[model samples]
Target: MSLYNPNRVNPQRPKRIALVIANPATSSSTGWPVGFWWSEVTHPYYVLTEAGYEVTFFSPDGGACVADALSDPNDASGYSRHDLISQGFLHTPELLARIANTTPVQDLVSADYDALLVAGGQAPMFNFANAHALQQQFAAFHAAGKVVAALCHGVALLAFTQTTTGEYLASGKTITGFSNQEEDQADQAAWHYGWLPSGQSIMPWRIETRLQEIGANFVHAGAWQSYAVRDGNLITGQQNFSGEATARLMIEALGR
Candidate 1:
């Protein structure tokens, strides 16, 4: 019997990973520019690429992407000062250029990739909530027996995604997203501290509540900690804090 060679890299047929990001949208509550969380994309992109996987970035509307102000490691607010992973990733000219330019997800065929990772930001609250086309892409990956991962606010899309069988993706599955308590705290602080507008919820709806409405077994690890869960090919991380951990879990599921 031959032992499996985990280190064997198939240079001729390298696996492909699809990184899904949301197109630019304004925060309805604060009118601030919104895009993706820097770490949510950079951290995972770094992990998967370092593991020798050929990764492609995409967005529903296509074109370049932006980072949420709070998620930018170099932002003046210093909100993400602790996010050195993203800071390091940003310093790489090649990777930084990739984020500055992304292909349209609509241009990709589902079968070309072995996995899909949806990145998070304040934008997903608007884009993913009712994105029928995006739901199809997420469901197709699951139906094809591929590893599919989403962390933080990106997981909000799962609340609206349904399998081909017409069941919600998170229905009867264990998952996590940016929690309601965390949202409340962040919103309150941003308001009280003048980081954003005051007196309204940052989002019109909550991720935790939406998942529960669809009967998801939602799990939380409290504020600002790494917590990720894997159920078969489905992987989810709790929040921005769980980005790299979630990517590793997805990589493990991909058997890489």
Candidate 2:
């Protein structure tokens, strides 16, 4: 018989991870209150939890997360219709509660977990950039040789985060995020993103552009394909499709 039990719940194993999210914020381009992406959160959450790691949701503002309507798997636009993983998460009362009430990111100390995963959404463009506490957390986790995973726009956190040596976190890191071509593809689509007063893209700066500017070796595959890269313990996923890929890498890194 195998010593491991897939159905066993190890309550005291001390294997915990934090999923960080952005509080609701206005999308500069669309003017909508944007929060976490459904697939970016649910897909990775599914993979991590099924692997038996205790996951906790954290937010800078500490409250309920509002889904980007376009990312809702059941949304009428059908943009994310194939996202049955998220569809199932939406239906789980207990799982749904985790996203509905997030613990404040500030309340978490470095000793609280083994790793951290940042979730993507339009809100990150508004808030995750240059947040001191978050940057510190990134540094702390990486310094501890623990996994630091970020997906989609959430990867933007590394663009401005720094090491104690005062270098940008992306300085020598190989990372990926929402790519430029993909953004251009979205721009040309029929989706109704809010127009800026200047009639330009609502996001003042692009995630890929900022990452490159800060010296990260950004990489990507096809326009909408799932792509994730692992550099040391730093893991980054390109977009929604990359979430589970990133999570799997983290599972290996955690040795779980």
* Most TM-score-accurate candidate: 1
- What TM-score would candidate 1 get against the native? 0.92
Local accuracy of candidate 1 as per-residue lDDT tens digits, 67-124 = 8888887888898998888889878897777777888776778878899999899899
TM-score of structure candidate 2: 0.91
Model 2, CA-based lDDT? 0.84
In angstroms, what RMSD does candidate 1 have relative to the true structure? Answer: 3.9
Against the reference, the lDDT scores of all candidates come to: 0.84, 0.84
Query: For candidate 1, what is the total of clashing residue pairs?
Result: 0
lDDT of 2 by residue, 20-88 (tens): 987788876667788889999988887887787878888877879888888998888898999999999
User: Which regions in candidate 2 have their CA more than 4 angstroms from the true location?
Assistant: 1-11, 190-199
Error of 2 at 243 (Å): 0.8
lDDT score at residue 11, model 1, on the 0-100 scale: 60
* Model 1 stretches astray by more than 4 angstroms: 1-8, 196-198
RMSD of 2: 3.4
